[model samples]
Target: MEEFEIDPQDLLLENALRVVFKAAEMLDAEALTPSQLKDLSGALRDATEIVLSIETACGCDHDHGDEEAE
Candidate 1:
């Protein structure tokens, strides 16, 4: 079997994505007002950019090339 290595930044990014997904799942997109939808969209965009930046800074691939299947 091949051994796998985990990068701290990769873990962080994964956790961040999980949080974002959970938050999204909790909200009813169809029921959101226009303004609220806009705000949520902006927040998600910001979160995505921040996570991407951190991944880059840590030299981790966007696809988490080094991450093992859980």
Candidate 2:
């Protein structure tokens, strides 16, 4: 068996990247109306906030989702 050092923040960042990439595929080479573009923008913004919440907590193990920040 092989063991490797894995940082939890790296895993979190990779997951966030996957989510953003999948969401971006929705707008790939497609003619999006203004409304659709706005919707996608909002979704991306929300995802950004969620990812940033980790930074807000200085990368603590605590989850900073939905509930108000302590």
Compared to the true structure, candidate 2 yields what TM-score?
Answer: 0.52
Off by over 4 Å in 2: 1-18, 60-70
User: Best by TM-score, which number?
Assistant: 2
| lDDT for model 1 | 0.72
Q: Pick the candidate with the highest lDDT.
A: 2
Q: For candidate 2, lDDT tens digit of each residue in 1-70?
A: 9999997767777777776897778878688899988887877787787678657766567655645754
Model 2 lDDT at residue 49: 75
lDDT of each: 0.72, 0.75
Q: What shift in Å separates residue 67 of candidate 1 from its native position after superposition?
A: 11
